[model samples]
Target: EDKVVQSPLSLVVHEGDTVTLNCSYEVTNFRSLLWYKQEKKAPTFLFMLTSSGIEKKSGRLSSILDKKELFSILNITATQTGDSAIYLCAVRPGTASKLTFGTGTRLQVTL
Candidate 1:
């Protein structure tokens, strides 16, 4: 069975604080790693990493994959209250076309 674990399941930070979120996985044949931000009912796609060591970035968010170590990290800089949301990590397999999601990390940004 494929599994994912996210560290610091809950976090609180003030505006302008930089935070790093972690995700580790154990799977049979890893195809890709995906990050998402969930605010409302729908979750927004953040990034999808296929190759190891390559970093994906957008705005104040960035993520890097590590296939050898079976892990990934997400960084958010200059955080604001708008950044408060649940960060989700998912893993896809090379064989099956399904996604296995982690418990997710909840971030709270204060003024």
Candidate 2:
């Protein structure tokens, strides 16, 4: 079974602070790692990492994959109060679309 683990289950930061969340996985036939931000009920897609050493970025959020280590990291810079949310990391195999999600990291960005 594919398993994912996230470090620092929760975080507290003030506005403008930068944070980095880590995700590591163990599985067979690794396919991709996906990052998502959940502010409310639904989770919004953040990044998808398939290749190692490649960085994916959007605005203040960026992510990179280390396929050799079977892990990935998501970084958020200049965070705002609105950035407070639960960040999720999921891994999917190449043969199927089913994803195994990690125990999310909860981030609280205060004013």
Candidate 3:
């Protein structure tokens, strides 16, 4: 069975602090790894990594995939209190778009 694991299930930080979240997975015929930030009820898309060693970035958020290691990392820089949310990592295996999600990492950014 395919599986996804996230480390540091929860973290607390203050504004201006930087944080890194880790995710590891094992899947057959892996297609892509997706990152999402969940605030309130919906999870917003962050990044989708499909190639090894390539980093994807937007604003203060970035992510990279290490296919050789079967893992990925998400980095948030100068986090603000508004950045407080649950970070989710999911793996898409086979040809289907169906994703297997990790338990999630809850981040709390305070003043």
By TM-score, the best candidate is 1
Error of 3 at 14 (Å): 1.2
Candidate 3 lDDT over residue span 26-84, tens digit each: 99899999999999999999999999999999999999999999999999999999999
**For every model in order, what is the number of clashing pairs?**
0, 0, 0
* Model 1 poorest 10 in a row by lDDT: 25-34
List TM-scores for all candidates, in order. 0.98, 0.97, 0.97
Clashing pairs in 3: none
Q: Candidate 2 lDDT, tens digit per residue, 1-111? A: 899999889999999999999999987798999999998899999999999999999999999999998899999999999999999999999888999999999999998
User: What local lDDT score does residue 94 receive in model 1, on the 0 to 100 scale?
Assistant: 95
Candidate 1 regions with alpha-carbon error over 4 angstroms = none
The sequence of per-residue lDDT tens digits that candidate 1 reaches over residues 1-111 is 999999889999999999999999998888999999999779899999999988999999999999999999999999999999999999999999899999999999999
Which candidate, 1 or 2, has the higher lDDT? Answer: 1
